[model samples]
Target: LAKEGEEGAVPGPDLVAAMAEQFAESANNVIIEEVNKGLNPGMIVLLVVATTLLLFFVGNYALYLYAQKTLPPKKKKPVSKKKLKREKLKQGVSAPGE
Candidate 1:
């Protein structure tokens, strides 16, 4: 009876160790699978956003360059203080000092 009870008892240390190892392998596989599943899409989204921002800036810069090329050069009329005083005098305006 005693031998039969011992034989029918729970598994030994080796079986327990094997079971623990299998459980660890399964847990590792699950962790790896989850990380892979999450990482791929996350990286894709990040790349898309980064690419969009890069293209946006590049396109804006291109448009800026195009506008600069197409626009006419600005001409600034040079006016001296003497010219302004002469014009004011012509318009019958008094000078600063009486």
Candidate 2:
């Protein structure tokens, strides 16, 4: 294939046919071996992936719920800038005359 590219030759019909046959034979052998082993590697991999994703989603949801329940509720307060300034001025004021 490398020599073919160097020779400026594109894969013609015959080359395509031969390559297809070679790939098909290899694929058939792989399928047969997997069947003999009685364990579909592809299905196992897919199952593991699905299980991992499910666990991740469930775990995150559980953690979110747990955090919400354990955390303290915030106090409701009506804030005002004037109130804050008054508090600061109060802190700065002197008590008796010098």
Candidate 3:
């Protein structure tokens, strides 16, 4: 069945076929050119390095978070006598020296 358009005539099957063939030929040419050139080694190396660095950082960060969640809390260091006295004074307790 022939399609009717505002112009009173639609594109014939032969014309459509020819247009499709031309488009396919151009697309094939582009594909062939890309295949011939292949991938850029420099770009591939850069991508590999970037991906390695990204994964390394991500793995380290994930490990850090896991450690924070799973590891025991650190023991507090012993306070010096002077620091203890200062803390006591801050809490309104007089130092032993008066």
Candidate 4:
């Protein structure tokens, strides 16, 4: 009967403290597990963003090169020293000397 009484004795404060500690540790482990489970989705999102930026830059570069190749060449203007001097004189501008 003494053994049974000892077994049935209410837990002391120390025992209660130990139980609380174990509960806290288990809760922490559960939270960590949940975070770990979400890691894969975070990595997938990172990969998708990187891929989108890469494609955008590549397409922009290709379009720029294509435009350069397809556009017509610009016409060259002929320069005349007499015309330039006349225009500058009319505009009240003068070159280095008379």
Candidate 1 has an lDDT of 0.85
Please provide TM-scores, in order, for all candidate models, with all chains considered together: 0.39, 0.38, 0.52, 0.39
Please, what are the lDDT tens digits per residue for candidate 1 over residues 1-98?
Answer: 34424766777688889999999889867644334445588889999999999999999999999999999989899999899889889999986775
**Quick one: ranking by TM-score, best first?**
3, 4, 1, 2
Off by over 4 Å in 3: 1-35, 89-92
For candidate 3, lDDT tens digit of each residue in 29-87? 76443356767999899999999999999999999999999999999999999999999
Tens digit of lDDT per residue, candidate 4, span 1-98? 34424867777788889999999889877644334455588889999999999999999999999989998987889878888888899999995478
Most lDDT-accurate candidate: 3
Off by over 4 Å in 1: 1-39, 74-98
The true-versus-predicted C-alpha distance at residue 73 of model 1, in Å, is: 3.6
Every candidate's CA RMSD: 11.3, 9.7, 7.3, 11.5
The lDDT for every candidate, in the order shown, is: 0.85, 0.82, 0.90, 0.85
- Backbone clash pairs for candidate 3 read none
lDDT of 4 at 20: 99
Model 2: worst 10 consecutive residues (lDDT sum): 30-39
Candidate 2 — which residues are off by over 4 angstroms?
1-37, 74-98
